[model samples]
Target chain A: MQESATTIAIAPDQPAPRLLEKAVVGAGARVGELAEADALIWTGKPRDFPSTLPASVRWAQLPAAGIEDFFDAGVFTAHPAVQFTSAAGAFSHSVAEHALMLLLAGVRYLPEQLRATSWQQREFFPHVGSLRGKTVTIVGAGGIGRALIPMLTPLGAHVIAVNRSGRPVSGDNIPAGVETVPTDQLARVWSHTDHVVVAAPATAQTRHLIGADELSRLKPSSWVINVARGSLIDTDALVDALTGNSIGGAGLDVTDPEPLPDGHPLWTLPNAIITPHDSNPPQLRLAAFADHVGANVARFVAGEPLEAIIDTARGY
Target chain B: MQESATTIAIAPDQPAPRLLEKAVVGAGARVGELAEADALIWTGKPRDFPSTLPASVRWAQLPAAGIEDFFDAGVFTAHPAVQFTSAAGAFSHSVAEHALMLLLAGVRYLPEQLRATSWQQREFFPHVGSLRGKTVTIVGAGGIGRALIPMLTPLGAHVIAVNRSGRPVSGDNIPAGVETVPTDQLARVWSHTDHVVVAAPATAQTRHLIGADELSRLKPSSWVINVARGSLIDTDALVDALTGNSIGGAGLDVTDPEPLPDGHPLWTLPNAIITPHDSNPPQLRLAAFADHVGANVARFVAGEPLEAIIDTARGY
Candidate 1:
């Protein structure tokens, strides 16, 4: 049987044409006539797309990891039967590494040394903490969490996984001696964990998952690393935590009202280390997402179950 | 058969009662009959004591890790045959952690962030190198070096051990799968390594091991972390390397002068992060040294091999 023709309809603004074509069409066909295609790959700003699409489009794949743009464009609500999956694991390793970087940076007091270059004498320096003997509580023990656990375990840290389902996932790569805790145990784990890495998908239930009360449970020396989403934490509450020294510090890759406006108090907080939500190291996200898309495309061709299928009702 | 009394000498300026009771006499031995003893334990500044010690002393144990002070006092020369041992492995773990802190700090660009907190949100911050995929060359792979290998391995760094003998020393707890290179391969490995951690003992032959020419071989992105004595690296050469950005950066826990003088150019170097040689974490030195001393004391009593026995000829 001839392979079904595919048309990858990427936004004009998308920087990577090769990536989009490879992800959607694979090696089976050329991007000849878009009008006679069976599949469509959507990318970039959805606001510029037409109100309606062709009936021949059997499936539509989004280029971005988060599907909020599709929702904002009312495509998901309008097309009820369309299959929806995300590039969820696309940036898992990069996000995990970013979180680890922040944790190590905070514990080692990189900021303090940077600020006071004049006082670089050996006798009057500050003593900093190490990651070797600490417990790390990873909220949302999915792909990113899984990636982080192995990285942390080798550094001599205890890994605790907390997920929404309250059930443990199976994988050989999970560090051999990690504790998988359900989300219900979060508050308890927070009381003692040395670091908290928020990697959960942003859903209604997860919004403000870590707020004032939860932050209070953490040790004064604890650090929070958020690579998941800004809504997963309460911004105002976090500012309080850092200012009061209730929790040691934070390494934020994402934040509320991102592109965090100029003169934001967080920029000045001595303990808060903020990055522009661009934590994905060069080529890491592309490689991961490409693998995901490839695997899904293969399964689609074989009439097999697609991995990482999103549930609209769950909003993940 | 009575475990014959061992006489220990107490210097005049020493804490008289305690030294006399503990070192000169065993606990509960007659304190007044100080002259009736078989051996002498030296417990005061050698200069304060007479030039010639009583020939009754069979061994001398110094309180410091480096026996340079005792050697300076001519103790080694005056009694060449007297078995001498100094506390070793005392600061191994602390120094190892300090080395890791510096490496992490340099790679994460902690120094830069503190300088530009005001404009942190306006633009995309530069991506700093990560230790996740790097080759670390550890010079003088002794106690501290061995302790650090395990820590570096977990962070996914390749550790190459460079030492005098070029023979493989068993790093019992050092993570498996690390490579060991002879000193002759130092220049060859320097070009390939992303990090250089100097842990060699300060010695005449080992001085300036990482000088101008050797440093010039390193990639511009590589970092140097020195937890070993400062003399191992030529201060002037390192300053030039930092100023020129020939090597990426440096984290120095120990410098030539114990207190790196205020207004020193090294303190102001943008690429260099200096900590006043006080990398030893609180109580680590005391506890580890005490354990070493206790072990040696037991070995002495049982006629067993001692730990960290200093080689007078090598002066390490």
Candidate 2:
């Protein structure tokens, strides 16, 4: 049988439909109308998925890496025929770099150091630290975690990665010399680590994963860095830990009740360095998403196994 | 010939005289009185060098890497017999990491990001950027510059290192693939670079090395990170550049007229991040200095060439 041209559509609800259309066309896929679209590039929120998804569509490409929202929305239970793929690893590079940035900032106390109006050299000296000879625990051995390993290793940090399973993750992204452990072992790893970077996907099981118990396990000199969803950490516990000087510091790119309200204690905390949930650089977001779409479209056209296919049961 | 016992005195004015004394004794050197010492560790300010020097001392170790003060004091011109070694590379790891921290903070608009009390995600998206694929120009291809190259290279930055000779420095400290360029060509390189990290020593020739003329050559989006000495960049020009948005931003750990006075314009500028010259962690400083002293004392006992020996003529 002769190969047929794949019919895809730039969803009307996408953040930038024109950009999606350009990417689809650039990838050699025809932009079909709603009734004819075999696949869709979904750019809308998970809550809006049910209303926007067409019965004709066989595949749906989600812009977000996290899919816990979809599971909560019951998309999997409703649509058995459609194959869903999330942009899981598309923004890994950007996000991993941000995590490193946050870690570096926390270790060096950049926030407090930058706040000084006077020469506070003597006061700041004891707080400053180098990443060298430090132990870093990455809680979530996925794309972002893998990307962070190489960057951290080059700085002489011993990286310990945590995944759902203790098994080794196979990928070019996984730098050599990293110790992979299961999530349950996170407690055992805390006391030895000087830094903890949260990159786990948000789920009921993982929510508040770094709560009071986990915070208490960490050394007084340890810093907590979260580039993943803020829900992964317990904000109340974090605030307490930071305020009470339980932990060295925290670099949070995401926060619970995000767009953290005005007069939040985190805003005033000297140890807290918040970046408004923007780990993925806005300048690189669309381009990276486009690249993912372009590659996946080619795979779909070739009748090959797709990348980032969401396991309906796993919801990652 | 058997190595003679070397008597060394830990300077009274040193930050941690007890630690220095312990290290010297630990390295097989006896702690002697200043008048009877064969070698001494001088930890006083550069201006106090002439008054503090003892004629009987044959070898003196300066705690700071930059020795511009000795040149102005005419100590080198007067005493040609005594061998002087500065703790040049001992603190490189700490300082380089701090420089990287400053660069990352500036690129992410950390100063602005931390200022937000609400989510303001959309407002921050456009300002966000990553160090990946950025051109970083590191002034002074010495220990800190060399250390920074490897760290930046892993993040995919094209590193251009500037030195007095513009020749590739030979040492394990120097990372591969970095382009070593002469200081004279800085004007030509600025437009292409996204960031400039000043790690040059403070000297008459280097004072105000990055003034208006140099700042103007850079792209308006470029960030300037200084971890070396405040004198390298003209502070007045820096404040003007940041305030006018002539450049992207400035991350200064060191500033002129040290302890930048309260109410300084640079303090209020949203684009400036000042850290009060505390790049070297105080915890690491004494230990690193002691290691350097121990190694140099060993070399002195063996009558071998010392490490970090200063060429007073060069005024570094």
Candidate 3:
């Protein structure tokens, strides 16, 4: 069958960004008016979403990874017939990169070195560590976990990706030989894995995933990095581990009582490295989003399965 | 023509190391005695090296990157016929990994975050930076510079490699598209490159390579990382840049005078990160050396050219 050129529309601006416009054209699609376009790229909020989409508009691409606000605003309900895809994996690269930085910093004992006023090479020699040949277990094998696998693999780290199912995580960027495990079997990994990176969602079942019991199983030099939601790790238990030097340290972008209250013990802890949760900042998001748009547009043109499909029933 | 099985001897220790044995065997060679072996893997001190080697010994693998001690001990002068490959690139991975951590930490404003006792997300948002789409000019296309290219590429950064020859840097692991420039033209790059990583050697021509002239040209957000000798960057110039906020920050593994004095300002500078020249700790050196042995042994068995051939006159 012969293919025809597809048309896509960008909303909330009379002239969309040159980046988004170029993305559409680069994907073999053209930027057109909403009335004639076959797809709509929503760059505005849920409230700004059109109550009605053209019948020709079979798909819509949202700018956010999570669309709870869109669902609450009834954008999904207003266009139940249209296929929806959220920007899920696009922003993951930056977050995954942050996790790697935190992990490397903690393992190499950068926190203590930063606070030093004198050369302590002899005293700090034993504390320096490397990720080479070390097993890094990433909880919640979603966008962040999958993004992290490739980055870690090049550094000679073995990855154990955990999800609800034991299905192996595979991608062009993610190298082969990665071990996959079910979330229920997480206990088996704590004692064996060298370090942990929390990238799971904040669900009731996942709350406190790394508590006192799990922290105790980790090696004294193991660093715990959290780029996901704050609740996944037990903050009190983490403080205990850092205070006692039972584990190496904690690199947290998120915390249980986030914006981690002023004067929190974590602030004073020498072993903790905090970043105030700015892994994926605003300046980087637009370009990442534009890239996502390009990929999905190409997929739509090919009539292939689109990425990050939103499940209306699940309200994801 | 048929190839003969190669024999390698591990000196000083009768058993040598099971790790080195496995590496030799894995590379399709076998372990044998010094008198009958075709190659020698020296794991002992320079003083312990044999004054004479078997006529059959065609190649030798030394365990140190910088063989000044071996040269001082007259090991090379003693054996003029055998080919020598020093452990140069093997240990660069650990040091390169440390460089990546420091660059990321400085760009993401990690030092301030580590010192914060309150949730400073709003205040920190503007400071958090991403390496994606940024230019990273790596000074010295030696082991560490080459090793780091692949690691940074995965994070979406453009690389500029500076070397004496200006030859394009290419390797099995290094991706294509890296821009190479000759050292004489380095003055033109400071205004354009987003970050700088000093991995060059310490020599008369290289002393204070990044001085007042270079530091003054860099952007306010540019980060300079030095895993090489601290002499490459002028201490006074770097301090001025950091204090004036002329550049983003500096991540230093080596400092001036080796074991910086107790009251040095680099230690207390918020924009500076000092690691006390421990990027390649002793504990991690052996494994890295073994990997280097495996690759060179495989080449020897195949009668191919080996890596890191030392030039006695250069004294590297």
Candidate 2: residue B296 Cα off by (Å): 8.0
DockQ of predictions, in order shown: 0.22, 0.55, 0.68
Best TM-score among the predictions, by candidate number: 3
For residue A110, model 3's alpha carbon misses the true position, in angstroms, by 0.5
Better of 2 and 3 by DockQ: 3
In candidate 3, which residue ranges exceed 4 Å CA deviation? Answer: A1-10, A13-40, A54-59, A80-83, A294-316, B1-9, B12-39, B45-47, B54-59, B68-73, B80-83, B294-316
Of all native A–B interface contacts, model 1 reproduces a fraction of 0.29
Across A115-196, the per-residue lDDT of candidate 3 in tens digits comes to 8899999888888899998999999899999988988987889999999998999888888899999999999988779999
Give model 3 RMSD, 1 decimal.
4.3
Candidate 1 residue lDDT tens string, A1-316: 9755434444444454666457656734344333665545554465755455567655556656667776777766665666667776565765676677788767766666556645454423344666665898889888788877876765567888899776775575675777777876677787668889999989988999999998988888888989989999999999999999988899887888676787888888988988767566444455556656666666665567776666765555
Which portions of model 2 show Cα errors greater than 4 Å?
A: A1-87, A168-176, A290-316, B1-86, B169-176, B290-316
Extract clashing residue pairs from model 2.
Answer: A259-B119
Candidates arranged by TM-score, highest first: 3, 2, 1
Q: Please give, for residues B138-229, the per-residue lDDT of candidate 1 as tens digits.
A: 99888788888876775568889998887775655766677888887777786678889999989897889999998888888788988988
Better of 2 and 3 by TM-score: 3
By TM-score, the better pick of 1 and 3 is: 3
Worst 10 residues of 3 chain B by lDDT: B307-316
- Candidate 1 vs candidate 3: which has greater DockQ? 3
Clash pairs (backbone) in predicted model 3: none
Minimal lDDT window, size 10, model 1 chain A: A118-127
